[model samples]
Target: MCYYLKLKYFTLHGPLPGMPPQFLLGNLAQSGLLFDKASLPEAHIAFKQRYGDIYQFWISSTRLIVVNNLNDIQHIFTHRNIYDQGDIYVQKFSIVIPHGLISSKGAKYKRHAGLTLPLFRRGKIVSNFDLIVDCVDKLLIRWRTKSPQHVHLDIVQQSQNLLLAIFGLIGFDYDMETLDNDNDTNKNELTKALQYFLSNFNIMLFSPKILSTIYFKLSSQYRQSQKTIEQYFDRMIKQELDNGKELIAQRKRTSLIASLVGSLQQDEEMETNKSEEDRKGLSRNELLDEMRLFLLAGFETTSTALAWFIHLMSKHPQVQQNIKTELSNNNSQGLLSLDRLDSLVYLDCVIKEVFRFCPPINGTVRTLTVDDRLPETGAQLFRGDQILIPFHSLARDTRYWSIDPELFYPERFLGADKDHHPYALIPFGGGHRQCIGQDLARFELKVIAARLMQYVTFGDGGNQVNSGGHLSKLTIIPKHVGVTIDFDK
Candidate 1:
């Protein structure tokens, strides 16, 4: 690979460092290095050894520049017009969520972002505080059955179930009613549908185009799973349209339904084709797309983050006790107030450290919309070239850290890494492409972590059981998240 004369892309500008395209099988054979769909964080680490920080590789017919450099990543994100969301990603996600935030771009992306932004803002999240607490309390009541003695829990799996149920009751007014069940198979019908989708999501999204095409052709199961998501989404959208107001009457607070309807009403893209009287904000498919975005993304990423927080807390009992102490010292009158949560500075640090330590999302992709050169490297980027900004690399990179970035130490957030590069610890990404539901995700995680600390102690399940290695699919999930719950009496 060091031999420039032997390099296939030597003529292409930029640093040409990486395994020499595997010669015959190309980067496809070394796909594990390019991007490990099964275990991305470690794979990215390995790629750093072979490819260095920024390098080029071939994924089937596509040319990709995988970068972990903070400046290059920030440039791609900040210059939105020059680098757009990869259309391949849009195409892949559109299979399940058409015109949704992940699938749509330009005007459609703005429309979705604008309507949902206010719904997840800090104020709106505060309003939903009680509902989130109620959800966690339900889990606590069930955990009471296993109190006094420690019971092993697959906390990652459990958090997924819990967050799904909470989203149902809060966002869509549908009760999952799965909290009482001991069996994974015994779930609400809608929950079951989601489980089916999760179980059979397209692994093809990460594969080479040739391999993915072959996989898609052979599997009707993948298509069926997509249909399952669409069917569940459309039904929910209809139910919200018909009885959303009545459902929210029980809460007396605004439901996310209003945003869906508002977007639906103001959507006038098809107005020129339809009569002046028949303009609609979102078509039926568009409404379903937004619902898919809210439901899937709303629950899954947060649950993974919370799961990582718990897994890390179990390993660091001293840190956990500090959070408990902070909770006690800050506890006062109006239960579950954001002010109270804000007072727990240590808990906030632990949360940031958890995000830094185990970011659920591996990274994101963008396509160069025009030919350009990177600021520092002067690398040539042709229009439509792909850029993979590895989130795990940036978070774990030692260059930007005053404290050792490798440790699970939260105090780094308080002292040494206080002025760390803004782009370094971004688990949710940045600029125009940032996740819209971050405020709500943080709110849910904080209240839930506080409630758990108040009610139970997450005992470390030892090195074998609590061993942390990520199982990277779409999200970087803990490979083994076993923890023993010691219920607080």
Candidate 2:
């Protein structure tokens, strides 16, 4: 009776249907969010089926209206002012990177986005083709060291190393040497710090606010990780600022750090006229936060996607062959240049299909700023309500696809579903606050994937190990990606 009364009290303003929430526990106890009953993606899919496209989800006392409909999502995404940064997402990321674009709001977010987005433009990313190719080739060489008879590879680790190396060089012009066996303490320390931070950050997201705060304050590992990250990024910032004037004057460099530092330099030069509120550049602390965000985002998403790609390729030998054949027809010398990579159109479709099939990010959350009604379902949304737009749900919805959304076919992009609704396959998300580094992520994935297909064939390690499942963390990664690598002469 108390539960019913409490629920009724909360639902006075038009309630959306959802499973009954337990006192204090909300729906989490039954939602399987922190349990083994179902992965996050699976749980969401089940929720959509049980409660229809639009429903209410409670994480503890916080209410999130989960919307799976494409039209509503499109509306929410299009109206940037109505649906701003997600409360949970911002709260979670703010603890680690308060001034970073992911966590910061309003002026701070605008400042970071203005200074940062230009560095990731498609032209700039394309220009780094040689650098990316070099990184991928290093991985290929490392893989080649293994004998074909004992070629069962841990692709997850390999992908992480490859992406880390690429992003390190591209973002900061720093050589992490993650791909090599270099034992530089500083490099390895950065790697360890980043891993520790991410793992704990994920934990904090699942934990209650007070518990998360207590953990952050008391955890020695967390403190150490924070210290290491600060020290390393400070050093990078100082190095860039030391050469900031030259970098800005030349305007030839395109590394993320350089661009950010150049902004700072420009800000300093023009500080006499402009007020602090109107300043275009980020502060040193803000720059450090952004760097941390970049390093984590740059490697984590792409690496997880690559892991899934490897797992999928292992299961689909014919798809691998098709990509290889496309590459062959494009480049006879087996070289993976930017032009060659672009010419492999089928491979492009495959990459898109990979994103559509199992996106690294399952959903993007948006917090409502005004009380409004959803266009399709007519569910009333209150101010401060966070709505989750599930990308996986949209990708799999039968209404959106002409080809069966259940089937993982790359050719779907080439045929009837070629002109699928723009909102139907938003892996990087939509709207103004969509991923700033999407072009870079896509370019890196294509380059690494193409280079891998050039010299290696990934074979299924069998159902015992190669069975498909996802481990939900910062990204949806393949849980079992054991694959045999065959090197082609």
Candidate 3:
């Protein structure tokens, strides 16, 4: 917390404070403190120390304002009427996911969010818990025969397999045998498509036009991946429409996409007497766009969270014991009753701490709808300017937490940090647009973590193999996560 002056400079948008000399490289693609890929969450802290909570990373025409303050993020997100998710997101992402909840604006956003929400409601998630855990059991069975005791498993690959299988079942009523098969090149088409698409979607979106022309010429694989995924959606949506009400009974227990399809089918059937223009059914392309976004968000977030949880548990044996002890006390005969999972208070704290420690989606961007001022620094901003709320900085700011923010202690939730600022640790974000699948994500994490702790012990695999860093892409995934798991009697 060094003393820094609030230096304001005039831009086309308005008066805004720019970054410090340390971030003078002024490159959003490389050295941007807010958007740096190599730096993970540390970049937010570095900029906060140099320029404080609110400032712009003004690189020429770019007027991206970075806000790490709780009040500021709260204000921006809470006032959804005033400020939407931002046009940059809509303009860029909508090209891929048309009318998707994240990409849709205003009324469309509300309609999509409201419609898809029931599928992720707490009751729906609980009833579907066993269905979700089916994938986890398959993964555990595979793990048992992978190698001998004290073997290092590439958790990055394992998590990808597990989540794809889980989401496949939940989302499409399909079985993706990514966990069973050993072949890489001949793996599931949807899995391959997702891996390729998420890895390259942003690059293709933001690259310079001339360079993008060159990129498209050279990116045959990327084009094929997108086409493959899109084709699958085309077939599914066409099948649902050409056939009729295939998944009505399992709508509540299935993926959000399934529910959407079932609902849309009902809408179409009810409007049989209406004109084509008056039909309420979602068009094929629109539903496909949402399906792509749903799969991308669904599989990535929970898997990344579980991977981090396993890594942390391996690092801190005591925390694992605490979770296991809680599970043992339940005396439940089954894998995990909803009541038993609910009672694991300590595991809940660990889940929260992991989200704070290393969030999958580090931060989100918003566009100002009207001229506004950041109250803390009094920096003036204009309409259409981009604002970034770095979750890393908010979670790490010592001022908001009673305990040290740098520590990996989950006990803080039960003790000193109990009263920590609500907006300080928003892994799934906050306000109206917070992650709709958070309840599902947390339930999945707890059930899997509890099962793992009950059946096995994570042995430290040493720094050489378990080297810690992160890969910042669609999600901030662990770049180096290798841990040894041994089954317990």
Candidate 3, after superposition: displacement of residue 160 in Å? 1.6
**Considering only N, C-alpha and C atoms within 3 Å, which residue pairs clash in candidate 2?**
none
Kindly give the number of clashing pairs for every candidate: 2, 0, 0
Worst 10 residues of 1 by lDDT: 4-13
Model 2, 1-489: lDDT tens digits are: 876746752342356788766665566668777664556677788889999999877666566788988778888998998999888877777766777789877776777787778878998789888999888878777677777766354677678878988998899877877877732233477778877776665466666667687888899988898898888777877876677577654653466888776665334557536764677766566777788889999999999889989988988889999998888883567666667777888999999999999899978889888987889877888888889888888999999999999888999988999999999998888898788888999999998889889889988888878887877778887777778888987
* Whole-model Cα lDDT of every candidate shown, in order: 0.73, 0.80, 0.71
Candidate whose lDDT is highest = 2
Scored by Cα lDDT, where does model 1 land? 0.73
Q: Model 1: runs farther than 4 Å from truth?
A: 1-15, 21-38, 57-62, 147-153, 208-235, 244-254, 262-280, 330-335
For every candidate in turn, the CA RMSD to the true structure comes to 4.6, 3.3, 5.5
Give the Å error, residue 149, model 3.
4.4
Clashing pairs in 3: none
Q: What lDDT tens digits, residue by residue, belong to model 3 across residues 1-489? A: 122311222232335445433222233444443354545366666666876778665432234678877777778888776566856566556555656778876656765665677778777677767876677777778778755455555687678778877776677665667777763446678778788877775464444334544675578897798799888776665654444555553553445655667556445455657754455545545677778877788788999988888888888999988887888884755457777778889999999999998888878778877888766666677788788788878887888998898888999999999888888988988767678888878887888787777788887787876766777767878877778888875
**lDDT measured at residue 81 in model 1 versus the true structure, 0 to 100:** 87
Model 1, residue 442: C-alpha shift (Å): 1.4
